[model samples]
Target: MLVYGDIETVQTVKEKQAAVAALLESVRAMPPGIARHGTLVTLFIGASELVQGVVDAGFHERGFDTLAPDQEAGMACLVRLAQEVDRSWRSGFASAPPPTGALSGLRAFNPDQIIRTRQAEGYAFYALYPESYLEAARSSGLGPDTRVIGIRSIGMSLSALVAAALGAPVPFTLRPVGHPFEREVRVDPALTHRLTSGKSGAFAVVDEGPGLSGSSFGAVADWLEEAGIPRERIYFFPSHGAPLGPQASDRHRERWRCAPRHLVPFEDLLLGPSDSEGLAAWTASLLGPLEAPLEELSGGAWRARAYADEAQWPPANIQQERRKFLARAGGAAWLVRFAGLGESGERKLAMGRKLHEAGFTPEARALCHGFLVERWHDARRLDRVPVDGGHLVERVGAYLGFRAGHFPAEEQQGASLQALRHMATYNTGQALGDEAAAALTTSLKDAEALEAKVRRVWTDNRMHAWEWLVLDGHLLKTDALDHNAAHDLVGCQDIAWDVAGAIVELDLPEEATSRLCELVQQHSGYPVHLDLLRFLLPCYLAFQMGACHMAAGALGEGNEAVRLRRAAERYRHLLRQPGIRQEQEEAPAG
Candidate 1:
C-alpha cells in the first residue's frame, strides 16, 4: 500500500528546523528495521537552499536518495522499500514507469487502507499564519494516520483554529511554548444555569467601579446572554445612595422596576449599607410578595421559602448544585438555599438557622463564604508592598454624596488646578527639607475638595474621568498627592503636567524613543492640540515600542534592570497621555 503524507513548511526557518527535529526524534525512537527503512520526503517548494539542506540531512542520516520530479515549484518524493531489501518489491521497482503526473499521483494508494492494513503511514505539520494554507490542506483532505500539528502564537483565535483542525476542544496555556498545545476549560451552560438559578443562585458577579465599564460590561453581558439568561432579565444594581424619606433615590429604582423582579440591593449590592435593617427591609420590599417564607440565618445567610413545591426542586440534584456552586464561586462567599422536606406536609422553616443545621440554605451560606473568599482573593491579587526607595506617588479623590450636577467647565478647570498645587508641594518636599515635606503633607488634604469639584463638573457635563484625562492629558493627581520624597523626585509627572513633559522625562531606551517619534510623525495631524500632542505623542510611541523591545530582551540575564528602567520610562510616558482622548473634538452645538 502507498501512503501519502502532507506537511506545511512556512517561509520561517525556525519552523523548518522544528519540523526536521520532530522528524529526527520520531525516526530515532522507531524500531531498527522501521528506522532504517523509513525514507524522508518533501513537497519541495522553490526554496533551493532549504530543499538541499533536507536532501543532505537525509543522505547523511539514512543513506536515502532524494529525487525531485521536474514539474512544478513544489514536488513530492516517493519513499518505498528497496528491491535489494524486500524481494516482493523487485519486479514493481524495475517495471515502474517514469513519473509523469501531478503531485496527486502520490496519493494513488488509499491512505486509510494503508494505515489499517499496516502497510505505510504519514505525519504532517501545518504552518501558523495566513490561515489560507491550512484551508488548502483541509480542502485536499486528511488521512487516517495524518495528525496535524499547529505551530503559532498562543491567542484565543489561534486556540480555536487549532481545536477546529484537530476536531477537539480549545486549549489554554499560562505561558507560550514553541508550538505547544493544551486543552481549554469548557464551561457548561446548562450546568451553570441550573446552579445559578432558583432560590439559591449562582451568579458570575463582576464589580463595575469607575474603571470597569464599556467593553468589560458588554463582554460580561454578552457572555451571560450566551449562557441563556434573557437580556431583559439581567440587572445592574447601582450602589449610589437613595434619597432620604419621601424623595428617595428613585434613579436605580426606576431602572429596576422595568426588569423582572429579582432583588439585588441598590446600595447593599455594590456599596455595603450603613443601616443593615433598613437595607434588608428595602430589599424585601423590592422582592415583593414572598413566594416562600424568608428564612434568615446567621452570618447574613437567608433562604426564601420554596417558590415552588418541594417535589419540584429535583431532590437528587442537590449535591450537583453544591459542587457547581463551589466551582462558580471559586471560594467567594455565597448563600445557597434548598426547600425543606417534611412528613406529608411541608416543614415549618424558621429564619436564621444555626451554622450547623442540616437544612441551612446553601445560597446564603455561599454568599457569606464568597465574601470572605473574594476579600482574600482580592488581597492576594493586589499583594501591595511598600518598596524602600520606590518612586511612586499616591493621590485620593472624593465627591459629594448628593448634588452630582452643578459645577460648570470653569469650576472643573479650577478643580484641576488644585492638582498643580499638590504636585508643586510634593516636588518641593523632594527638593527641600523635612519642614517642607510636613507642609506638603498638609497641602495634600485639599485633594478631597479638588475631587468634589471635579466630580461636580464632570457630572454636570456628562463626562467621566477618562474623558477628562483625555482632554487634559494627565490623570487627576489625587491618587498621587500623598507620596514620600523619593516619589516626589523621580515619579512620573503629576496631573499638573502636560503629556509633552511626561514624554520628555520618560526613561525609555533609544530604539523605543525613535519608534515613538516615528508613530507620532505618521499619525499626528490637524485639530490635535500641538502642545499637548507634542508632549504626549513621544511618550505613547516610546511606551508601545519599549514594551516589545523589553519583552524581546527579557530572556537575557544581567541586563534586566536597564531594560526594566527603559520599560518603566516608556510606561510613564504612555500613562501621561491622560486618558484615551478623541483625535478631534466636535464643534460646539448650535
Candidate 2:
C-alpha cells in the first residue's frame, strides 16, 4: 500500500544558496516560457529551503518568528519575485537575477535533509502548481500577520507562496516525523510560545496532499491545538478536494472533516474564468483546432477502447496513474497526456523527440503546462495482433538496445541492489510464502556486485503486452516517459530489467529470448548482462505481483479487482516458471 521512493539529500543553507544562485542564473538566461516557469519555481523553492535552513539552525538562539532582519528582507525579496510570476511573467517578466545577499549567511546554517517535492521535480508529473496556492491564499481572509506553518519538503515552497499572497513575513516550516498514518510534530517551548503569543488572524498549514492519511496535516494541527491554539484558527491548503483515504485515523479524519480548507481547483487553473487557456484551446495551440471534447483516457481506460476482452485487460493503479486524454484534431487524433512542467517537461519533450525520431515511439508534439501531445496510432494492442515471435524479439531488442546505448545514466539512480532484493523478498513473502520469498533472495544473493557493474538508464518499466501499439505490423511503445522516476520503489535500473520484463510480459521462448539478447548486443554493441538478467527476472515478477495485489486490495471485490488478483496470481506463476530466468549455462532454476 506504501509506494514512494525519492532520493533527497541534506543541504546546508550555504549549499542551498549556491544552488539557488545557479537557478537564479537559469531564470535570468531564459525567456518567458514553461522552462523559465519551472526554473523560477525551483529557485523560489530553494530560497525557502535556504530560509528554513537558517531558521532551523538558529531558532534556539533567536526569539519567536525566528528570523533575523536580513533573513526577513530576504523573505520580502522572495515575495517580490513571486509578484513577478503573478503579473503574467510567462509573456515577459524581469530578466534580472533574483534577489539574495541577506540569505548568504553560511555560518548560521547546519545541514538538514530536504524532501523532494514530486510536484516540482522534473515538472513532468504532479499537475499541482504554486499559482494554485497563491490563488487559494489570496482568497483566505487573513492578513500579513497570519502564522503560516508549512510542512517540510513541499510545504516549504507552498507555504512561502501562501505567506507571500497574505503579505506575511518568513512563514515557519516543520517536518513531521513518525508513522505515515499517525504523525507527530515537535516544537520547542520557546518557539511554540513565540508562534502562539501573536494575534495572527489565523494559522495556515500549507502542503499538497491529505493523501491516504491526513496525518501530516493532523500532526501540525495537533501540535498547535496541544499548545492551546484553537482548531478554528488553523486552516489547510491541500491540492485535491478528495476526502482523506481509508487509512486516516478517527481523530485525524474528524479534524480534516471540519477544518477550513481552501484551494483553487485544477479545473479553475486549467480553464480560468474564460475558456481561453482550457484543454481544448491548449490542444489547438499545439495541433490546430480540436473537433471533440478531450475524451477522458486515464486509469487504463484506453484498454477498454483498444481491446474487446475486458477480463484480460492489464492492471492499472487508478489513483497512481497519470492524467491522460484523447484529443482529436480533424483527420488526425492526438493523445494529450500529462508529461510534466518546467525542466522536467522540457527534458521529457527532448527525450521524446529523440525516441520518436528513432521510430520507436509515437511522435510527441508540443508540451504545454506539463502535458505532452502525441500522435495516437489507431492500432490494436500487440497481444490482440497476430505476432511473429522472431519479429517481436527483433523489434523489442532493437528498441531496448537503442535506449541502453543512447540513454546510459552518468550515476546510478533508483533503489540500491540490496533495496531491490529486500522489496522482492518482502513482497513475495507477503503474497506467496516465506519459501517462495527465500527463492528470490537466493537468486539475488550475488547481485550486490552486479549493482556496481549494471549499466543504469531511465527504463521503460511498463512492458505489459497491452502497452504496445501495432500500426501496420510495426511495434510502437507507448507511455515510455517518467516511470524510471515514478513515485515507486522500482526507480531506475539496468537495461537487463527491461529485457527481463519483455521476456516475462511477452512470454518469450528460450530460442526467442536468446535471439532477443543477441539482437540487443548487435543494436547497442553492449552485451546483454546475462547474469543480471537472470537475477532480475524474479525481482521484476515480485514487483508486478506486489503492484497487482495492491491494486486488487484498493479496488476490493469487483470484476476489476478480480482481474487484478488473477494478474497477481499470474505473476506468482511466472516467478515459479523455470523458463523465466533462462541462460545457456547455469541460469536460475525454474
Candidate 3:
C-alpha cells in the first residue's frame, strides 16, 4: 500500500516535472507482487495526480490495473492520516532560526569522504544513515522486537535506514504539517492507536536533521515519552549533529547565537558547529538561502508518497543556492573521529595516541601539539590583567618577556610546557644532562615568587569584570600537566619494551614502579590519566601474554615468542637512541 503525505516535496514547476519523471520510473520498476496489491496511496491532490499518471501510463503500456489512493480503502486511510496531520500543523505555526550554526563553512557537508573511510575506520557512517532504511524494522542495540517512529522526510529516511540495518521493516513516519522546514508535527490517530495498543514498550525517534522549530520531532519524542517509553529508550538517530547552544558555555555562547534548536545544517552534520557566528553567516551568504530542509532530501520512491505544496516552497534563489552548495560539497566534520558538543582534550589526545600506535607519528604529534597549543593560548589569554596593562604589554611580556635572552615566564606552565622543556633539553648545546639540570633548577628557584605574583594579579579586586572573566575562565580551563602526562605515558610504553629487552639480552632488571608513580603525579586528568591506565594495562597484558606463551612452549615455533622477540629487538634499538639514554641516565639515580 502507498502512503501519500506532504505536498512540499515538489515546489517550483521544474521540481514538479522532475517528480513526475522519478515517480514514473519508480512505479514502473515496482515489483509484481506489490503492484498486484493494486493500491497507490497519496496524501493530497498534487501527489494523487502523479500516482494517477503512473497508473494510467502502466495500464496504457503494460495492461496493468493499479488503483489510486482515493480509489482504495487502505490507501484512503493513509491520505486521511496525512490530512489529519496537515490540519494539526496549520493550527500552530512557529518560525525558528535555520540550523545554519552546524554548517559554519563551505566544506562541511561532504558524505563521500566520510563514507570512503568507513571501511578502513570503525566510524558510524552506514549505521548513521543505513542504506537499507526502506526495509529496516529495528536497530542492533535496540533489540529485534523494537519498532521505530520517524519524522517525515529526513526522519523517515533515517528510520528506514536504521530498521534496514537491524534487519527490520520500514519504520513508521510521523506526518508533518505546514512549511516542512518549520512545521508542527502531529501523531496520526491511527499511529497513536497502533503504539498504545501494543503490549507497551520503548520505540525509536528517528530524524535526519533536528532543525529549527523542533515541534515535528519534538511531537514524536513527547508522544513516545507520554506513551511510557523511557527517555533513554527513545532512540534518537539524528542524522545531523546536535543543534548548537545545547551544550555551549559562556565562552561559546555566541557561536551559534541564532541557530535553531531543531535544525541540523548540512555543514554542522558534516563539520562540528562553527566557532563563530560570522563564519556561519558568511557560509550562509556564500550559499544563499536555505532551499530544502536538508541537502540530502531527494526524490526517492518513498518521498513520492508525499504531495507537493508550491506555496510553501523555498524561494527560487534558495533553490539555486542549494544546487550551488551541493556542487561544491567537499568534507564532512563528522568524518573526523570526534566532532560534537564541548571541546574534548581527552578525545583529542586519545586520537593522537591511536595514530601514533598505528605508526602515523607526524599526524599523532600534530594532533597532540595542536591541542596543547590551543590550551596554552587559552591560558595566555586568561592571564590578562587589563588594569596592569593592555593587550600589547600582556602579549609582549607573557610571550617575549621584557628581559633579553630569557624565555617567557608564561611558557613555564600550561599544557605544552613539559614538551617545550623536553625539546629545550634535547636540543640545547649543554652537556648531556648537566646543563638541562642546571636550567631546570634555576627556573624552579623563581617559581614561588612568580606563583605569589600570579595569584595576586588574578585575585585582585580592582580588576574589571571583563578582565576577571578572562582570568577566571582561563584558570578553569588551563591544564599545566598534559604534556608531562603524554611524555610519561609514552615513556611507560618505551620502558616496558626496554625492560623486556634488558631481561632477555643484558640480563638486567630495570625497575619501573617508582618511575610510573612519578609520571602519574605529573598528569592527572582525562586522556592523560585514562591513557596511562589504558596503555599501561595493555603493556602488562602483552608482557604476561608473551610470558605465558613462552612458559607453555607455545613460542617453540611460529608463535607469539617470535613477535615478542622482534618487539624486544625493536626496544633494544630504541633504548640506544640519545634521548632514551638521557632518560635512563637522568632517571633520579634510583
Candidate 4:
C-alpha cells in the first residue's frame, strides 16, 4: 500500500528532475512478483506542473493507482493494508534490474546503505536520518508506536530519514503535498520491502516553519487523513519562532478549529498575543501549582507635575519651598533624583528636604513615586498633552491657579519690575536729542497733566467700561505670548499689571498703545483694575519725561540740566503712586 502527498520542493529544478529519475529506477528494480502484483499508488499533491510530471513519470500506470489525500483514516490504502497485514513485514526481496540507468547513474539507491556510508565518513548520519524517517511515518500513518526498521534513501529525504530512524517502513514512494523534492525521491528497495511487508505501519510527518500558513496546515490535514492516523491522534506543532500578529493569530485559530477532529493543533509556547487574556488564563492552568501575579505598571501624571515645576527659575533660598510644592503636587522621589539640575548640590538637597516635609499620605506618595519611576525608566512612554497651545494655556491656568488658588506672588513682582525698567530705557534712549524741544518742554511745565487725567477718570468712574474692553482684548490675544508662561501670567494679577506697566513705560508710540489696548479689550472680557492702573502710570511717566527732555534741549546748557533733573524727579514720583506700589508689593519675585 503506497500512501503519499506531494509538496512543493525547496530545491532547484535540476534536483527535482534528479529525484524523478531516481524514483523511476527504484520502481523498476522491485521484485518481479511484487512489482507485477503490487498496487503502486501516487497522490498528486503540489502544483499542476509537478503533478503532471509525477503522472508522466508513470508511477500511476500499470499496477499503480491514484487518490486524493483525504482526512479519513479508513479511506487511506496504506491504513487498510496495515490492518490486513497485522504484523511486521519481511525485507530482502529480490527485485528486477533498473529500467533506465538513472538510479545507477545518479547513485540513488538504498538509503540504509547511504546512512552507513555517510557514517563511515565521520558524519552524524544516524542523528540526521531519524527526522526524515519520522516525517515519513507521520505521513504514512505510523505514529510513536510504529516500529520502522532499516529504511534507506538514495538522496536526503527528511521523511525517509525519520522512517529509517524509527525502523518503520519507508514506502516505495511517499509524496508529501507542498514538498516537490521529497515527492520525487526514490526510497531504497530494501527499505520499501520492509515497510510493505507489513512489519511496521504506514505514517506521515509534516514540518511546520516560519512560512507555514493556512494552506500548509490544510495540506497536513489531508495527509493525516490519507495516512490512516486517527485525526485526533495527529498533532500539528507550529515552530517556536513563528510570530503571531493579531491578524495572523485570528486566521490560524479559525483554520485550526476547521481541521478534522483527529488532527490536534499545538502552538509553540513562546508565540502568542502579549496582552491576551485567554493566554493568561491558559498559562495559569499550565503552571499547575505555582504562579506569580502579573502586576500592572504605573502611568504618567506625576511626571507631568515634575516637568511643570522644573520649567520655572527657582528662588535663592526657595529650594525647600519648591520641593514642598512638588510634594504636594504628587512628586515622586525619583523625580528629585533625576532632575537635570546644574552642578550645585544645593538644589538637589533642597528638593529632597521639601519632599520629606510635605504631608502626602503614604499611599498617595507611593502612587506618585511609582509613576515617577516608571516615567523615569521609560521617558518616551509619557502621554502627550491633548489641548492646542492657546487652549492649553487657559486650561492649565484654570487648573493650577484659578480653580486651585495656588498662584505664586513673588516671581510675578520681580519679572514685572524688570520688564518695566527695560521698557523705560528703550523708550527714553530712542529720543536723546530732538528739535521739537521748546514746545515739548513747555508741555512739561504743566506738571498736573497726568494727575489731572487720573483724577478725572477716578471721579467719573465711567472710564472703567473702556478699561474693561481693553482687558478683554488682551485676554483674546494671550496666545501671542508663550503658552506655558502666559498661563502663569494670567493666574497672577500682579504679573498682568507688571506687563501692562512695561508696555506703557516704554513710551511706545500712541498707535502701538492703542493697538495693545484694543487687543486686550477684545480678549480679557472684564477690566482688570491693577492692569489699567499700571498702564496709566507708565504712560503718564513717559509723557512727562519726553516733555522734560525736549524742554532741556531747548533751554541752553544750564537750563537743559535743570529740566533733565526735573524729568527724573517726575519719573520717580510716577513710580511711587499708590496703585503702582500695591502692584509691585503683590507681584511674585522669581
Candidate 5:
C-alpha cells in the first residue's frame, strides 16, 4: 500500500504539515503487514527544498521510507515507463505490459504516451503548457507542423521543448488573465487572431490532466470557437483524468462532443483498461461532483427582469438627462459612480443583473451591494473626492428589508456576518450608526444561535466546511452557500463580533483594530468585491480616541484636554455629506 498527498494544493506550510501528518496517521491505522511496507510518496514538483525537507522530516519521524521525486527523477521515471509502450499496431491495450510504481495509472503514466497516442491517431500533438510531457512529445518524431499554445510558465517551457523537438513550425503562447484559482481564462486577442489567422488542419489541444473541471481544455476550446475555428477541427487530448484520475463525466464528454469535437482520452492510449477503470472509479468516488455550472442558469431573461424591476428610474433616462444637463459630462461608465438618487444607480442596475444571472438573486443582491461599498471607497481614494457613505447605507437598508422577508434562517445568519463586517470596517455608526448597531446586535444574536445549530448538526462530522453552503440551483432564488462557505461566514462573524464589541464602546484594543483592518484589506482584494472594506478606518480611530478622551474627562487635564479637542476636530472633519448631513445637522450637539 502506498499513500500520497501532493503538497501543491495547500496554501500554507502548516497546512502542508497537517496534511502529511494526517496521511501518516491514516497509514498508521492500517494492518501492520500493509502499514509496515507502505511507502509515503510526496510529489513536490516545483516545490521549495524547505518544503521538501519538512515533508521528509515529517515522514522520517514516522519511521516510513519516503521518496520526494525531483524533476529529473520525475522526467526519468516518465521516460523509463515510456520504454515499455507497445507502438506496434497489432498490440492490443490488454496485451501491453502494465506499468507499476512511479509510472502507475493515468495520473503517473508515461508522458511519451501523449505523442504515441497522437501518432496512433494520425493527428499532430498540441501539448498544453505546464505538464511534464515534452520529453515524450519531442522524442515521438512528429512532423514540423505541430502547433502548441500554452502559458509561459515552467510547464509550458517543457512543452515548448517537446514542440521544438517535433520540429513545430508555429508555436504560440499567452499569459492567462489571472491565477489558475481565479478561473479567468482569456487568451490575448492578438494571440487568438494569430492562432486562427491561416493554419488549417486537425489539431489536438493537449493538457497534462483534465482536472475535476476540465476547464483548461474547455477554455481553449471556447477560445478556438470564438476565434471562428470549426469545433470539428479541435481535439481534446487530456493526458490523464483529474488529479486522482477520475472518470470523465458523461456531461464533460458530451460537452466536448458538441459540434463533432472529439475527446480522446490519453488514459486509453497510456493504460490498460482495468487499471484505468480502477483509478477512475477511485477518483470519481473521492471527488464526488464538481461545482455546478453557473452558466446553465439563464442570464439574458434574468437581466431583462432585473431591468424591468427598475421601472422607476432607468439608467438610460438618467444618462439622457445627464447629457442634456451638462455639456462636458462623461459617458455612463464615468458617471456611474456619482449618478444615482440613492445608491450608484448604474452599478446597482449592473450588479442586479449579475446577481440574477448567478441564481443568487435576492440574497446575492446584498453581497453585490456590499461589494460596491468596496468599489466606492476605492474611487473615493483614487479620485480624492469625499463620496457619500450614506448612499451605501440606504442600499444596505433596502437589502435588510428584502432579507427580513425572503432570507432563510441560514442565509440570514450568513448575511449577519456580512453586516457585522460591514459595520466594523466601514464605521456603519457614522452613516447609519445607531440603526446599524441595532441591526448588528440582532444579526449577531441570530448568527450565534445558528452557530450553535451548525455545531449540533456536525458535531462528530469532520466534513470540509465548504460543503455547507452549496446552494440548491433548483431553487432559483436560494442563497449560494456551501458548508465551506458557511464556515467562512462563521469565522468572519466571530472576528466581526470582536471588532463590533470594541467599536461600540470606543475601547477598541490596538490588536483588535489591526486585525479588523487586516481582514478588511485582505477581503477587499477578493474577486467578488474590490476595495469595499476599511473605508472608515480614520473615522473609527477618531471615534475611539474621542470616546477614550470623553471618558477620561478633567481627571487628566493637559493631554486629555488636547485629545478631546482633537476628537471634536475629527468629528468636524468627517465628511457626512449630502445624504446624512441634514439629519445630523438637526440633531443636538453631543
Candidate 6:
C-alpha cells in the first residue's frame, strides 16, 4: 500500500520538458516495434510531466483560485496536454509513431516545477484505459451545468474526459490534503466562490479510486457539502462502482452508500461485447489465436490453478500482487501480465527477457499494450515442492548474482545503508522492541563508508519461496522484474540486498547462507560482505514487515489479511532472534 505509491519525486518543469524533447527525437527516428514502444512510453511520461507541471504552476499562481479568464485559458491548455498524452498512448499501443508529430510542437506552458506521483494500477499494474472515464461519463445523466472537479494527480487527466463527456467547461483539479483515511481539501475564497457561485445541477467529483479508503473522495465531498452543496446535487465518478475498501470511515461509507456514483468497470472496457481491442484480441497477437477464455491468475489465484490441493498454496498478500491472467494459445498456456505502460513496462519487459536469457526464468514472448505474454509454466512453487536447501541456495545465488552483475543501474538509487538501518531499527522497535532492533544494526558501525563500498543494481527485491519455480529440472524465478523500479523506497541496491533477502526469506541456516553467498560471489564477482548482510537482514525484515502491515490494513479483516499479519510477525521473529545469520561463513575474498 504505502510502499509503492507513497514514494514521490519532485523535478523542475524544464528538466522533464528536456526529457520529453529527447524522447520525441528518439521515438521519431526509431522503427515501429517493441523497442520503439518503450521510447513512446518514455515520451508519454515526459509529456505527462509537462502536463502536471502546468497544472502545478496554475494552482501555485495566486489568482488561480478565482477562476480568472487567464487561468481558464491555462486550463484549456491543460486539456490539450492531456489530449497529447492520449495520442502518445495510442501510438504506444500501436507501436507506431503517430502520422504527424503528436504534440511535436506542443506549446511551452508549464510551471517551474512538478510533483510526480507513481501511476500504479492504471500505469503499471492494470490495463486501465483513460477512455473508460469518457465512457463512464457519457452513461451518466448529469446536465451541462454540473461543476466538474478532478482530484489530483490522476483526476487531473480523468476530469478532462468527464468534462468533455458532459460538455462542461474545463475541469479544475483539487489535491486532497491529509491522511489516507481522513482527507480534507483546503480551498481559497475564490475557488469556493467558483464552486458555489451558481446553484449548479450537480458537482461531479472525478478520480480513479475509492481505494483502501475513499478519503480523497470524502475530502472533496466534505469540502463541497460544507460550502452548502446538497448531497444529492453532488455526483461521484469513481473508476469502479464497488464499495470502498474496509478501511473506509463510517462517514465516507454512509455518504458514499447513497451517493450517486458512476463507473465503467475495467471488465467492460477490456472484455465488453463491443471492445475491438480487448484482452482476447491483443493477447491473440502474442500467442496466436486463443483457444480458451482468459483465466484470472492474480490475487494468488494461480495457486488454485497450479497446485493440486489448497494446502499447498502459499499465503500471499492479495493487495500487493500484480495483475496477471492465463491465456491458452498456440497449443500451450501462457501468462499475460500487466508489465506497466511506457518506461515502467518497457523496463520490466527487458528484465524479464534478461532473466529468461540467463536461464533463470520463463520465456517471454512479446509486449502488447503494456502487457507481457510469456510461457506459463505449470510448475509448483518451492512451498509446494521439496526444496533442497543446497540447491535452493545455489539457484537463488546464481539468480541474485546474475541480477547484481547484469542489471547494474546508472547510480546508487536504492535506499542507503543509513536509511535502511534507520527504517529497520525504527520499524523493528515498533513491531518488536527498541532493544532487539538496535543490536541487529550494531555491526554497521560506519554505515556511510560501507554503503559507499556497495555497488548499485536493479535488485531482485522478491526472494520469497513462492518466487522459485521447479520446472523441467531447472529452478526458474517468476516475477523476476518490476520490484526495484516499482514505486517503493527499495530501489536499486547492492547485490547484498538480494543475498540477505534470500537468506531471510528461506530462513537459511549459516551453512546454506554461506553457500548462497559463495555462489553469488562466484557468479557475479561481487564480494559478499557478511557484516553488510548482517545489517541488511534486519533492514530487509523491517521493510517486509512494514509492507505487510500496510497491505494487511488495505486487505482489512479477511483470512488473507490475517495471513499477511502472520507473515509480518514471522519477519519480526527473524528480526528479534537473528538466527543462523549469526552462524555465518567468513566474508568472501574481494
- Candidate 6 lDDT over 1-590, as tens digits, reads 22442434456666765667677778778776545655655555456545644555556664333454433554564455445444544453444464344554344445355545434346655556566776777789887777899887767667866776677778877767677788877677767976687765789999887887899999989888888888898899987778977789898899999998888887786775631357777787667777878888888898887778776666676755677889998789899887777566667778888789889889988887678888888787776678667777778888887887788875535677787777777777778676765665575556887776678888888888887888865788887776876656778788888887887777787778778878888888887877677767767888998888877876678777887888888887776666544556556753
Maximum-TM-score candidate = 2
Name the better of 2 and 6 by lDDT.
2
Top candidate (lDDT): 2
Better of 2 and 5 by lDDT: 2
Candidate 5 is scored at a TM of 0.25
Model 3 TM-score relative to the real fold? 0.25
Q: lDDT of each model, Cα atoms only?
A: 0.25, 0.74, 0.29, 0.28, 0.30, 0.72
Error of 3 at 234 (Å): 0.6
* Candidate 2 Cα outliers beyond 4 Å, as residue runs: 9-26, 29-39, 42-80, 89-124, 272-274, 308-312, 410-412, 578-590
**Tens digit per residue, CA lDDT, model 2, 149-216:** 88866676677778878888667777676788988776667878878886647899988887778889
Q: Write the per-residue lDDT of candidate 1 for residues 1-590, one digit (tens) a residue.
A: 00011122223333443443444344334443311222111111111223223333333343322222211121121111111112211232233222223223222322222111010001111111212222322343332222221111112222222223323322221111111121122223453454335442222211111011222223333444566656554432111122212222343234334532211332223123432332122223323332332223221111112212322221111101111111122324222222211100011111122111322111122111011111101111001222111121110011110111111123312223244344434333433445754654553444445343221111111111211111122122111111111101111221212223323333333333333333322322211123333322332333333332433333333333344445444433453333333343321121
TM-score result, candidate 6? 0.86
lDDT against true structure, model 3 = 0.29
Superior by TM-score: candidate 1 or candidate 5: 5
Q: Against the true structure, what is every candidate's RMSD?
A: 29.4, 4.2, 26.8, 34.8, 23.0, 4.0
User: Over 4 Å off in model 5, which ranges?
Assistant: 1-44, 47-144, 151-190, 206-219, 225-228, 239-255, 259-590
Cα lDDT of model 5 by residue, 98-123, tens digit: 22242221123222221100010001
Model 4: per-residue lDDT, tens digit, 1-590? 00111111233334444444544544455554222212111110111123223322333232232321221111222232222111111121133332353223222222222111111100111111112222334444445454322111111122223334344443223323335222222333454443335433433433333132434444444444444445555343332223432223454456456532221121212113442322232223322221333222112223343235422211111101112111111232222111111111222233223323431101111211101111111121111222233432332222112211222332321223333333333334444323322333432333333222211100100111111111211211110111112101111233234334333333334334334333333333222233334443543354345444544443436533464556555554553332333323222211
Of 3 and 6, the candidate ranking higher by lDDT: 6
**Model 3, 324-392: lDDT tens per residue?**
111111221100111111112334445444433432211222221011111111112222333232332
Higher-ranked by lDDT: 4 or 6:
6
The ten-residue window of minimal lDDT in model 2 covers: 115-124
Candidate 4: what lDDT? 0.28
Model 1 segments more than 4 A misplaced:
1-144, 149-542, 545-553, 560-564, 570-590
Report the poorest 10 consecutive residues by lDDT, candidate 1: 116-125
